[model samples]
Target: MTMTIKKQNRAAFLGAIALTLAWGPALSFAESVDDKIARAMSAAPSDVSAEATIMDVDGTILREGTNDWVCLPGVGLIPGDEHPMCNDAVWMKWMAAVGAGTEFSTDVIGVSYMLQGDAMVNNDNPMATDPNDGGVWVQDGPHIMMLFPNMDMLADLPRDPFAGGPYVMWGETPLAHVMVPIEAK
Candidate 1:
């Protein structure tokens, strides 16, 4: 009986070692909380990101802040993509709705900052995952986004991203917003 117990113990120890060896590299690649906070803060200007709460893509709060803005380390469907953004309260509500796959509406204007630029996305369909899907695809650079209560107000804005200024993205959808480019891509 003593010999059998020793054998079992040795097997368990070996299994633990194998598990560690298999997973160690993946675990090491995980981002630290401090790193996530730093990346999130880079989404907006110093004035907004300094007092903005840092959050993960899964809605996990990484760091608490004093202001109404919330910053995120990444957004979009691209694997390993880091398109950080800082959003105000109104945009937060809109984001929640988007995540929950529900309709979103607001009575006031909302703002979001993506000073680090954004991942490539189909500007007409928020659900589009492929860039080559024959849709209007754009990869904006260092821009601010605005959402209004009435999308009808966007009727006059240029829908083309290369129009040289602010334009309407997702114009036909309820999630339509104005994209104000700050710098060239």
Candidate 2:
């Protein structure tokens, strides 16, 4: 009788697992993967429409283009924040350096647009434990981030409030990028 009871319990557990697996595809994707890729690519310059290549997070080809730009999803290392980004080849090269834990001088002026940012946290998330630990969460609204060709070029950008735009982000690090807030439609 005990053996029969154990077998029944195991069968019930397996049934539940099977049901979840069956429903996972429908439930996991809020939207189609192709739609997600298209949305991510829209953050880039429309002029590059014919020349831009887009790929999903898994490195699968979604749409083919002829330009030097690539795009991906990023929300400043934060979860639940949906900020898709499009970056030129120059910026992607810089990203490779960043990934290898090394720094490299920029060659061509690269640009990345994150016009869909949900929030711009004022500080870096140093403590990996708390993604939002660094500073106040400012809904600075939608914005575009720029990658300068020269590291020293940052100082040359307008710092005065009257300049009406541009702020230093990710301070005191090579991971820094310029944030320019824009009016979201």
Candidate 3:
């Protein structure tokens, strides 16, 4: 009876330790907005001469920059099918450095410039009623903007006030904006 009890206690202690070790990385993955922004900026190109700015929920500018892409770090940009707008290669690199594992939803604003290939394609998601088609394609110029919400104030506001505008414009030609959510490894 004594030997059995000793073995059970040892097993329980080892299990607890194993569980903590496995979850340690995930616990550290919950990063702050500032950390994410810094990571994104570090990955961005220095010679492009673009700017990055982070805004608060009240429309106040928290941080601004003069660089290639203005990123909100962990935020996503949704592009419509009509006018795809973004460099996928560059975006992928940025997300990778920021320790992926973030969730971003698409909010399509509107459909301007009625061209032949500019018609919005509906992916049949009723929640996305806007003509922008919820970030399906890249040709749809600056349609998607990443949102960084103030967690404390978000619950009290009647509507979502964290709607963010585009930070980076992918040159002259508006390709498709692809906001791929990265999972933290």
Compared with the true structure, all predictions reach lDDT values of 0.75, 0.53, 0.27
Output the number of the TM-score-best candidate.
1
Best by lDDT: 1
Better of 2 and 3 by lDDT: 2
Candidate 2 residues 60-131, lDDT tens each? 445665666666544323444355677665555455544434564554566777666644454443223443
TM-score of candidate 2 relative to the true fold: 0.64
Give the per-residue lDDT digits (tens) of candidate 1, residues 77-137: 3445688899887776666555445677877899999999998888888779877778888
What's the ranking of the predictions by TM-score, best on top?
A: 1, 2, 3
lDDT accuracy of residue 27 in candidate 2: 14
Tens digit per residue, CA lDDT, model 3, 18-120? 2322211211246555554444344234332135443211112336544323332222222211121221213323232222223322232221111112223
lDDT of 1 at 4: 12
lDDT of 1 at 69: 84
Model 3 residue 173 CA deviation in Å: 19
How high is the lDDT of residue 108 in model 1? Answer: 81
